[model samples]
Target: MAKKPLSAWPWENLGSFKYAMYGPLAANVMYSWIYEDSYKHPWCVHILIICALRGFMHQLWNSYNNMLFLGNCRIKQQGVEFKQIDNEWDWDNFILLQGLLATMACLMFPSMDDEFPIWNTKGFITLMLLHVMVSEPLYYWMHRFFHGRYLFTHYHSLHHSSSVPHPFTAGHATFLEHLILSMVIGIPIMGSILMGSGSTSMIYGYVLGFDFMRCMGHSNVEVIHGAIFNKLPFLRYLIYTPTYHSLHHSDMGTNFCLFMPLFDAMWNTLNRNSWQLHNKITSNSGENGRVPDFVFLAHIVDVMSAMHIPFVNRSFASIPFSTRMFLLPFWPVTLMILLMMWAWSKTFLHTFYNLQGRLYQTWVVPRFGFQYFLPFAADGINKKIEEAILKADRMGVKVISLAALNKNEALNGGGTMFVNKHPQLKVRVCHGNTLTAAVIVNEILKDVKEVFLTGSTSKLGRAIALYLCRRRIRVLMLTSSTERFQKIQKEAPADTQNYLVHVTKYQAAQNCKTWIAGKWITPWEQSWAPSGTHFHQFVVPPILASRRDCTYGDLAAMRLPEDVEGLGSCEYKLERGVVHACHAGGAVHQLEGWPHHEIGPIDVDRIDLVWEAALKHGFRPVFQP
Candidate 1:
């Protein structure tokens, strides 16, 4: 590791408030437009707009490159980790700083007069010419110079910190490096303006194009088709691909050119295997794509959560899921994404991680939480789930764990539908409900002899009731179905069957301080419980904290193994590295190499077994405190 220099931006510690750096420049532009009536001199306003455009363009690339469906095109197979995400979180800081500097430069240069038009072909050509002559060679040398011992150790090393480059990784640099970059980028634009060839469109085009190219190079995903280089041959020297720049990060000695490989070739600094490696990745996207040891079949929660996936926004997804005011404006865009998914999308890989040397991935079905209840949407959702299972089976995946709504009993019978349909599946289909049951039951304190249980007719509920009754603990089963209650009661021995008491109303559990709610309880129902009663729930969208005195535990979840790697994003509302019990259950099954499918009803005898297995594999329960 190189020693970091004290080149941090003054505003670096300000966090998101660092965006306020744009306030002075934006106010100046707005003042000129309103009070000063300087309509012709729109240069200041254009600077602000260009900054906004570049920021948007950079985010688009970031989102697209991290998309799991497009993973095959990725230059690096390993996933981005939390450390890299933290390093790049402030990537947009450069945009604000550069915008400020550019605005000041416009004020300084008298040649940048108030006479601006919509477009200028001459200005566009001039900017390109300047970029090739000045920006290209100057940046190539500066980039190479930074790689030298002193500069690399003190400055350029920050930019190379991301082993797997993301789009924002391009902007992640020391203050001194960005200052140099601003000068290199500004020269071409300023040259066009100084030569009287500058226009509004040319400035926008050049700056946005510059950002686009930078993002493309750092995107990790190789989007440029091999045929493009093959057809032209000369384009290889004229342009650089994602693979070209990625090679620079990995090897650090070659492919130093900014946007064009022409300079690298001239200096003999280009990586010789760049083209061959690019083709290998792009061609690996078909039937013989890479396989994983375990697959977690996940689904969308709702409209608000659709954009919370790792590919959509790394910063947003890295934290616990929440509704952001900034994201509200993008709701229409999210709705469009949903419509597209409803129309053509299928099960696609959303993210993945490594645990104990095994490759584990999360493949998401294109259905939202509400869709799973639409009755009409059941078959469609199930079809997507089945397709994902069959695909995993074909890919030689060891285990496929159905998550959340994907394993709903009414929708797919807890993944039993797929396993029974394809009995010869080499890949085991798992609902992970056994571990879910284990987590819920284990949540009960050992000394508690009596408790209230809701949704007692459900699979997990039945398992919990049977398990508790065998321990001589009284489980007051809250259910309207006597037949369902009797069936579960019979599963226990006659000596303990009396411990499984069925209750028709919430009033029956008034004296019990421990409440296990598998179903959503209304305030009136919750009120029936005495004060200080704790609510441990497995209900989706865990019931709200309605009573101040009563405690509420989050949904059943387990912290992933401490050895888990590349877990960059949070799993829903749970804390980082913590996943729903069902997801962990699948992981344990894969680690233990359980031969049989864990679908349908959970076996009561296996509850303790799964719990012990999870602990053995380093999975811990989410501590309540």
Candidate 2:
């Protein structure tokens, strides 16, 4: 490890608490406003607001660039993992430190301390000219100097650690680097102020514009089309694109201009292929390019959970899903977007990651979880699923698994509808319920000889019942239909057939300690379970643990292999690095090179086979307490 720079900031060790550095300054400003003579100036307050605005701008860029629907224009197709996320977690520290430094500079410099009008044309022009003549060259040289041997190893290399740059990557630098950056950035603003041309709007515009360009350069996605530069050829030398900055990271020897290619061109440091690469990325080079090995078809759980998507709020998505009080205020806006999606949006890729050199992606249907339960919305939901499956087939995706309600039996016979409709389709359609049943059954303790099962007539329930009966553990299958019970019972071996006992009332399981809940059970129904019962559930919005004495297992999930890469987001409520069983099942199918479609009924015989395969691939079950 390289030694820490002597210029490191004092609050470097504060972690998230570094924001407290702004507290004393803010309190002083508030005191002046409330009781002191400086109350009328409010320049201090403006500095605070600018700090917040800069942080918000970075977040907006980070979120927007990560949207997978905009994948075609992306300069780097690789995803940022937890390591990069952690490195950039403190990206806003620079903003806070710079705000403090700016406040100090205002107190020290007489010219910058005075207030000016809100808008000044002269100041805006001065800012722009000073930036072009002075700031750009200064930054260009400082950037190049940092890339040299000594500074590169000690400081600038920290910035270069992120191979795939993100918007926050703009601010993720060592203290010494940001200190120099703050000085370089302040030059144009200070020049405008020193010349008596500075105004409120000019400071705001100049600072915000600096942040905007910096973010644009590191966004990883190419938002600027090459056609604009084609029409105005000189503009290429004037403004740098995301691709230009990306080349600097990849090659580390060229494209060193801060926000303009003019300096790079003059210095002969510009990469010859910069414009060509930019055009290639923005134009979507290959018409039929880059197919994933597997696709997990998913849907939104609700308006709040919708915000939990990777592209929306990365920090929130990285952890398990939960309702956040801060997100409640944005619910109305999210609902509006959801409504718009329901009306027109189709299945779109949500995220992708590499596992064992194979690509796996998650594609989401526009419908929310509630829509799947609506009788009127079934046709619309199925239409979206079919469209996704067909698209996957055309892309040569080897396997596509239906997640959550997407594979509900009543809706599509566990994804069998698509296979039968398009019999010649090459992509394998998997409901992944077989492995889901396996995870749930394997969760039962070895010594337990009897289990009470609810939703026994459903696909998973039938498989679970038969699997348990084969193990010689008696299964109290709860169902109203004797014909359905008889059908599942006949599938079991004749010797174990008696173990699959059918019961109509929840009271029949009063003595059973193991309750497998496949359907939602009422509190009254749950009241009959024995005191020590454990509820292993497959039902969505898992049944409330109404029984205080009973323990509840989360929906079946498996931790991804240790070798999985770019898995920065969580799967619904599962823990980090863990995924829902169905998602893992699909991944296992792809990894095993399984040629058969894993749709329709859960084959009782293949339960252990799939479970063993999951274990072999380093996917461990998340056992319940």
Global lDDT of model 1: 0.87
Per-model C-alpha RMSD: 2.0, 2.4
- Residue-wise lDDT of candidate 1 within 40-157, one digit each (tens)? 4566667778888998899899788877785447677778888899888889888987888887787787656676678888888999998999999999999989999989988888
Q: In lDDT terms, how accurate is model 2?
A: 0.88
In candidate 2, position 613 carries an lDDT of: 97
Q: Which whole-number lDDT from 0 to 100 does residue 436 have in model 2?
A: 93
What's the lDDT for residue 225 in model 1?
A: 85
What's the TM-score of every candidate structure? 0.96, 0.94
Candidates' lDDT values, in order? 0.87, 0.88
